[model samples]
Target: QIAQESEPGLAVYALAAQADMYRWRGDHAQARAVLSKARQLAEEKGLDFEQRGLLPVAEGITLAESGEVKAGLRLLSDGVRFLEQRRAKRELARARFLLAKAHLLAGDKPQAVGELRRALDLAEEIGTHQFAVVEGQHAVGLLKLGIAQGVAPCRALAEKVQQLGGLGAAEVRTGEGAEEGAASRLEIYALGEGRVVRDGHTVSSSEWRTAIVKELFFYILLHGPLERDAIGVVFWPDVSAKKMADSFHTTLYRMRRALGGDVVVVEGGQYRLGDVDYWFDVEEFEALVERARLLPPHAWQAEDLWRRAVALYRGDFLPEVQRVWCVPKREALREMYLEALVGMGRCHEARREFEGAVGWYRRALEVDELREDIHRRIMHCHAQAGRRSEALAQYHRCREILKRELDIEPSVETKGLYERMAGKGPD
Candidate 1:
């Protein structure tokens, strides 16, 4: 009620929680009614919450109980898929547990067991046991299974359920277990466009408190576990040490609040982000390129690795940021991207795939437009493809771009290639 009166944008969460409680009590009508309000409020107010997925899940379970089993099951399945895509592990585990109950009630013991096992595994992996409702639901399912499938296999499950019954009164704790549960699985892309995708949702700049906060995020990621002093020196170089400390602490607090406290941990006079599993596009690009480089040119996997690396280089690292610190790293990644592209082109050239070779070389030219070497390669590919006019056109395009942009002509090798393509011979 307070949420509805004071902060209505958050009211949908309370409604969803009430609906889950109703569902736990087996009051299908009340569950559905609460979910209806939640869905309506969520739609009307544009409220985004992690618990929003619970509405569909609870509704599906209610429908399954009221004898609309197939429709209910379908909704349940869809809800699970949706939550999984959202990376809502807690919600997904609950949904799976509910689906298991539905399966057991419908007399599909094997399917019920399968769903229960999946729910348990996911819950354990996420390190959360807050769902006593889910545990009760699971226990009930296992009891049914034990009756039908004999006592031996479900003995341990029965024991687990007994343990879960006492955990309802447990306080929601925050340290390692909770941190693991709440830590967003991030996929950061800093290679080209900077994107911080947390749990499959791309965090918009609007979500940040300030540009500095966002930069701090990338800064910590780029240079991990820096001391408070070192960080101050880099970002607040002009400020006094005491002033820098105050500003740094304030910024750090905001970062922790915005990105999760566990995500930015301070310890032993230094700060580092939590050990969350993350995939950085730049790291992946480098790994793929390194692997590709290690393989022989004719190796089947080499071309695929090189292409994957090229695809990952979306642009220069954090192109919008003009910090002095970002310059050398950005240039290094650009060079790595170019190397992968050129390597792929050469690999295709060696395989007698002239058109494929030209495609990659052209891609390289798109990044480094002044690369007369790639321009020469494109001309060679066009000539080999029997399009002499296009070959000649590519040479002229290269020559014009160089002259217009740099007030310089193509190199000797480029000129030689142009002459050969012009049928004036290599001399």
Candidate 2:
């Protein structure tokens, strides 16, 4: 009442919050009445945007609570879209969360899960710029409900939200170890081969009950946290959403059971593996490369960092996993590995260690045989070492590889190197 007496906007916000509480308690009539009053007040004050934007969300939740699922969902969707168009991300996230609630009330578990995931993602995104622990708490609640109802992925999501909320609202930040803020006790190797080592002990693959469970575990590791729907699309592409959801839950259960409860943490709709401290080889590799980048280009320490980073790539990333999703990540990691090799080569070249530089350049070619730039470097290294014939031969290999693979000749850069080695300037 005091809010209403003071600022009309404050009263509107307060009324909306109250209506939300009423809806949560299942007092649909009271929620609707309160929201209607709020709407009326906003309308009287010409608060069209607030009335048009936020009131619909409140009324939608009220309608959903009253068992008007279809009508409620429609209004919620429209209201969310309206706010989305207006770039009101916080309001959109809130509306989506409410829509998930409506889906649950409507007995559409799959849809509810999907909507909840979207809400959580949106909330996490918003939390990056603004603090919103309330959204994290709501995600935790919904995930708990999912667990109670026997949805497998929720267990991990609940843990993730708890962690995000625990480390303050900002912890929901994605990418580059947001959940695993500090170094972790769990060490996983997905580069070359896939392995999960706890402490110092390597977990045997034989212990994984099913291949799908193992695949699911690595998939989450590679992609960080994932939503149930996304897991469905990737792992069970041919199955219906309902069937895939069931299969995904079953696999997730197996994942929790096999790896331990804290192995994977699901935040809202995504599954991640960072309840405790954990380490992934690929992540470490990337981190090492990133650290080297911070040093001066010719810094001597970079040689060691690049060597250590390049050495970590035992083979192609997750070669055992034949999923198409792994391809891009594998390619990306391979490129990073090759770049590390190039960095090491450059470091050696700077020191005039021609043999060592040639070794690194040749190793780079083994990974990416089509690198004309590396070929050029190798030729330079041979020429510097007084291996004039070997230098000329290296240029020949470059020309042949380019011709056969790309059906194109070597770049003018390579031809110029050969001409310089032969004591003939370009015409």
Clashing pairs in 2: 156-265, 156-266, 157-266, 157-267, 184-277, 184-278, 185-277, 226-271
Residue-by-residue lDDT tens digits, candidate 1, 296-396: 77788998999898778877899888779899999898988998999998898888798999988988888899988888888887887898999999999
Query: Model 2 over residues 69-109: C-alpha lDDT tens digits?
Result: 56788888888888888989888877877787667645566
Please give the CA lDDT of all the candidate structures: 0.71, 0.72
State the local distance difference test value for candidate 1.
0.71
Q: What's model 2's overall lDDT?
A: 0.72
Query: Which 10 consecutive residues of model 2 have the lowest summed lDDT?
Result: 174-183
Question: By lDDT, who's the top model here?
Answer: 2
The 10-residue segment of model 1 with minimum total lDDT is: 169-178
TM-score per candidate, in order?
A: 0.55, 0.56
Runs with alpha carbons beyond 4 Å of true place in candidate 2? 1-184
